[model samples]
Target: MIINKILNVDDYYYDVFMSISESLTGFSVNELQSTGLADIYYKHILGQIEAATFIEFLNTSKTILENSYSQDQLNNAINAEIIADPGMQDMANNIITMWYLGTWEGAYVNDLSYKEGLVWNIMHAHPPGAKQPGFKSWGVKPVNSNS
Candidate 1:
């Protein structure tokens, strides 16, 4: 059938993502949501790795062009490195965050250098049992040491 090729491509894409996510996080895509970052080693580690990997990838790509490496070779190398890097997996999670946040109000990549730490601090610096400042106040978290 003419549609078979497209259907197979869709299935292949889903299978690839599912297998990779499961290997990295030990949770299928469906299972990872609603789980606290702290409770999941793979998810937590992946996030950090992803950020660092992307930063490295940008530097590497720049270096390759500066050094006059063949564009095709450089592209292949970079692709391989990203696939092997756990950090890229973590970056995927954050990319999802960026998507969820929409356009970021015209903020550029440069803004991230200044803004990431500030946002991180504000999100995590709340007092014990405190509701996040901008988020809805759900009174008193139940007794969970991690919370």
Candidate 2:
């Protein structure tokens, strides 16, 4: 109930989830948002974990972002607080997994999530079965062919 209210308060908290995710996943916000699964993963994680812990995770991430002066500081702070803290670490790892693998709790969230996995983007390849390459297009893919 409160998260619904807080989420509506701004551009999805100007997407605090995105900021936390960028710091955690080593992916820029643009890259994360580009996957089209950011919001879905956010809500998905909420469903997988306790809401209050996730919220505290968000706040801790926000504080780290606000207080840190450089990238190293940000990384250190995240590792120390968000990743190392017992309450947040599992959720942190799960978020990273969701971003990279498009799955939550070892299961794919949906076809869209699968197709849009960061793994595909990072590996510069699509899921083999995601789209028929048309037998003719099967040669070594052009470097830019991942999309």
| Root-mean-square deviation of every model | 14.1, 3.5
Error (Å) of candidate 2 at residue 12 is 5.6
Q: If scored against the real structure, what TM-score would every candidate get?
A: 0.25, 0.84
lDDT of 2: 0.78
lDDT of 2 by residue, 42-140 (tens): 767777777677778788778888899999998899888877877688878888888888888899987888888888777767787884546666676
Worst 10 residues of 2 by lDDT: 5-14
Off by over 4 Å in 1: 1-9, 32-139
When summed lDDT is taken over every stretch of 10 residues in candidate 1, the lowest stretch is: 100-109
Q: Whole-model Cα lDDT per candidate?
A: 0.38, 0.78
